[model samples]
Target: MQAISYWLKAYGESHQNPINQKIHKVAVPGIFLSVVGLIWSIPQLSLFGFSLNWVWVAAIPALVFYFWLSISVFILMLAYTLACIGFIWSMEILNWPVLPISMLLFGVLWIFQFVGHKIEGKKPSFFEDVQFLLIGPVWVFFKQ
Candidate 1:
């Protein structure tokens, strides 16, 4: 696997436009939150008196990838992921209609993501390498 810097540079190649950068800075976190919420809304199982869901299941491997990339990335993503999970939990507890809300946010934010790429005049990095999907949040939070 390439080093973290390699991935960073590759992801950075097409993100030079300031507007795209600003759009991504806001949209990516929102997207991440919606994604987690969508998964969290999955039918949960009562495991040892806990409401368990697919969100927890998915986060494990994603975090492992971050840990493999670099400890700083792992710690940052761990903290962010936990925070996102906590927010999802609160939404569930408040009965705020997590599923529909997540779906709305996901669709809207993805539109903005594509718009940002349009403004940048380049395809999104994920088109070249799917791993860029994961690298995106890291790029937004890791070095920024």
Candidate 2:
């Protein structure tokens, strides 16, 4: 169980280049939102009067991961997760093509992310450990 600082520090190593940092400042959040959108596009289910979707189901483990790290991290990630969920919900209400849109945005953001890594001359830390995928939003959003 690495601490939040440990994960952030590790993730920061490959992000030292200013260009990479700037690209990540936007790409990370876009990637997060796009992922949530992709999950949100999944067919929803109902249980005991509550609607459940893949995004909602997935959020629990992710939130618990943050909670395991620190309370402040948990709170911040909870808020961020809810915000993304809300935005995805709005897209659903508006009849937006969330699936295709998320797929497109996800691809585009990854291109920027790979470019950032190329400029930094380091492979993305997620290559070392998949959990870095979860830490990325925390680093990009505020915890950095």
Candidate 3:
């Protein structure tokens, strides 16, 4: 099996419960969007008179890391990153409070995640390995 497959399988172990999977369907994307929105909410910088937020800069390292994992995963992450950027732009256009909204959603979704794990009677995979955190979103993406 490939590396990502292994990580996905291990992550899948505790997530076998149908209710847990359903919870993850919502929570994982919520968590991802929250983090992205928070990062994108950082103050913009003028570089050579070009305005850019830290989110664009920060995505480079993250994309690099994902690329090292697998090309397909890298492509998926790139698509997700672009979607997040679009979301941030839309929220800004609407004058929505990005940081507060992201944080509130993050907290609420995490609570649901814990509840789902409790229903499953198993610990989250991230407790065993931090990399599982990255694996989770991709796993959900492929499942869809």
- Total clashing residue pairs per candidate? 0, 0, 0
Task: Write candidate 3's Cα lDDT for 1-144 as tens digits.
Answer: 247778778889999889999999989988988988988878889989999988988888878877877999999999998998899789989999989999999899999999999999999999997878888888888774
- Give the alpha carbon lDDT tens digit for every residue of 6-121 in model 1: 99999999898999999899888999999999999888878889877899899999999999999999999999999999998899899899999999999999999899999999
Q: What are the TM-scores, per candidate, against the unseen true structure? A: 0.94, 0.95, 0.89
* Ranking, TM-score, top scorer first: 2, 1, 3
Write down the RMSD of candidate 2 (Cα, Å).
1.4
User: Which regions of candidate 2 deviate over 4 angstroms?
Assistant: 46-50
Show model 3 residue runs off by greater than 4 Å. 45-51
C-alpha lDDT values of all predictions: 0.91, 0.93, 0.88
lDDT of 2 by residue, 53-108 (tens): 98978999999999999999999999999999999889989999999999999999
Better candidate number, 1 or 3, judged by TM-score: 1
Residue 108, candidate 1: alpha-carbon lDDT: 96
